[model samples]
Target: MSIPAAFDYHPAQTVDEALSLLQQYGDDAKILAGGHSLIPAMKLRLAQPEHLVDIGRIQGLSYIKEEQDTIAIGALTTYTQIERSDLLQQYFPLMVECASIIADQQVRNRGTIGGSIAHADPAGDMPGVILALKGEIVVQGPGGKRTIAADDFILGAFETALEPDEIVIELRFARPPAHTGSAYQKLANQASHYAIVGSAVVLTLDANKTCTAASVVITGASMKTERSRAVEQALIGKQLDTATITDAASHAADELELVSDIHGSEEYRKQMASVIVRRTINSALERIS
Candidate 1:
């Protein structure tokens, strides 16, 4: 890969300072968190920002804590941190599972959740998990801070709703209801460990083993992470059994704008989506209390 184009670096210790720098530089600046994604893109000349506002030094932006009814995660929290977090293990084990399988140890230690989501790679594992869990992304800009639902935050490949002057600060996930369980399943590329196709599911069950609510999201098969509304609609209010799950999972790729590439053809990805979705939902059901 070619060396990254020359760029100026500014280290910001506070969120306000970061926002100010972003405003000053506008679209010419890129926020650097762990640099796992940004640096690679820069080296490949896919991105050539003139200024990099390094926010790794920013405090209060790398924590995992419960706030009121939500589990709040700082944007700069690395994948390794999520993989090892006791709190996340207890409350959102699917996130832990997802984190554990991302890339490899070295990448996980340096890849921030915010950077991954903001990069919005089609094969990224985080976006589907967050969408399934109904998380919110909190961002700060020149005006003020605001929260965007995960469903609306990620727009497409390498795209998000963030303004040029905004930086992601936090991610918030509401505590799941009792008897809720979640799972993530991926068909990983052997070389890079990026998902060829992945699915995430969250299911809330009643005492009778009926699914009260369901969220099914798939990534890597498409240009962006997307909820499988047809699959969800087929599960809610129904008793989850092998037959039901099989039927619902058949819709995993419904309406999805699947991408065809060297990793897999569109048809191959569509077929695998159903298989992974089934496995993910079954795994989630087994975890329900």
Candidate 2:
């Protein structure tokens, strides 16, 4: 049996206390939420923090609420919560679509969105979805609270712009305008179910069905979720149809350096990137009335 390295455990009941623990432990500590990823990494000896700060018990950190202009979700909100949220189903079905397929029901029930984003795994689905929506992540540290644009938050594989003491507190997205639709599509690993290539699209169309604004983000093809300006530019001002979407998807991952592993080559992943982007765009456009 794989055994994790011994570490001191600190359970925090409040965000402030969690912050204090983080500040005290610094780089030697890791925040434990959901524990789906971290615990396995620990068992594999991939992560060996000296202190484990348990924030799973922190109150008021797990919620999904609709604000006046945005949807504000507490950091600790679970995948199951997001998958079942009526507001997300109605306003941002893309999130629900992605969330419903993450791992399995048990993992979805326990895995928190904040932990997933903070981990910044290349195969993660939420990062691309959030990026496509032009969302923001709220994080708190000893210095104070700050908001990070989703595009700027993720730096590389297994990396983020978060500081050692920073704790992600919430994620927010401006409510998409009328005529806007979004969707996510991924080709995942058969065993682990992690994305091999994931694409997310958000588009707003005018009365004539011409795209006014468009955002496309691709994941698992590269180190971080990547925004494809080429795809967006191709779709904007154009009437989206099979041909236009296919042409635009050909530009997905054109600028980013793709990842290659034992499972697939860089060229294979890039090709799949385009394929997923095309499918997601088509799915999103069909969602519009």
Candidate 3:
């Protein structure tokens, strides 16, 4: 399983270095953050970039910090680091849930947050999770820096709004307001280690024990991980009860074009989306209660 031959492997000590390489080589240049996705694609001859600009060596860019409003996570942060971060555990346990479900320990140790988002796989846990949390991506290019909302950034399967010269630097999101809680649940495929169905729910409750707002973003069950808008609209101002939960869950696949691989059928994934939506929402609601 050797990767295809490339002309150069440049370990960049900074984002400017990587951007310069990209500018020089244009389409033949590829930014390598963690190599979890690109390496596999290269092995299959699916990607043929002539130059790889490694960004993993950059320092001072792998931290989880809580600002006055939002929490900031560096792009180079590892899944294991996220899973073990005490600040994340207290402020955003849903991320820890995503970390635990991504893969086994070895993959988590090496797979980076930036690489996962850049790969933009429809079945990725964090992309769908960050969507639910309304995360924002901070990217830098030759011109300067720009921030894109999570919902707007992920365009489709293996696609994002990023330009060729852009490099993701960090992710940011406001901490879920008090009384808000979240959870992530996934059903993974055996061989590919991709999710057949993954759902992350972030529930914001009011003082009266009612759902003030919610987001249910599911992946692997569709062409791309998408927000269950019908479900979210159904939960607003509703009491977090079993009967209401059931009703909301019924709308899980209201307008989805699910993907069917050897792992499962369209009908099966749709059915499971409803189930995971119910379970994940309930689990998150429990935390808030």
Candidate 3 residue 8 Cα shift, in angstroms, is: 1.5
Q: TM-score of every model?
A: 0.98, 0.98, 0.97
CA displacement after TM-score superposition, residue 248 of candidate 1 (Å): 0.4
Clashes of 3: 0
lDDT digits (tens) for residues 120-147 of candidate 2 = 9888888788888888999999889999
Question: On a 0 to 100 scale, what is the lDDT of residue 127 in model 3?
Answer: 88
lDDT of 1 by residue, 54-115 (tens): 99999889999998889999999999999999999989999999999999899999899888
Better of 1 and 3 by lDDT: 1
Q: After superposition, how far is residue 185 of candidate 2 from its true place, in Å?
A: 0.8
**Pairs with steric clashes in candidate 3:** none
Q: RMSD for each model, in Å, please? A: 0.9, 1.0, 1.2
Q: Each model's C-alpha lDDT?
A: 0.93, 0.91, 0.89
212-240 per-residue lDDT for model 3 (tens digits): 88989988898887898999999998997
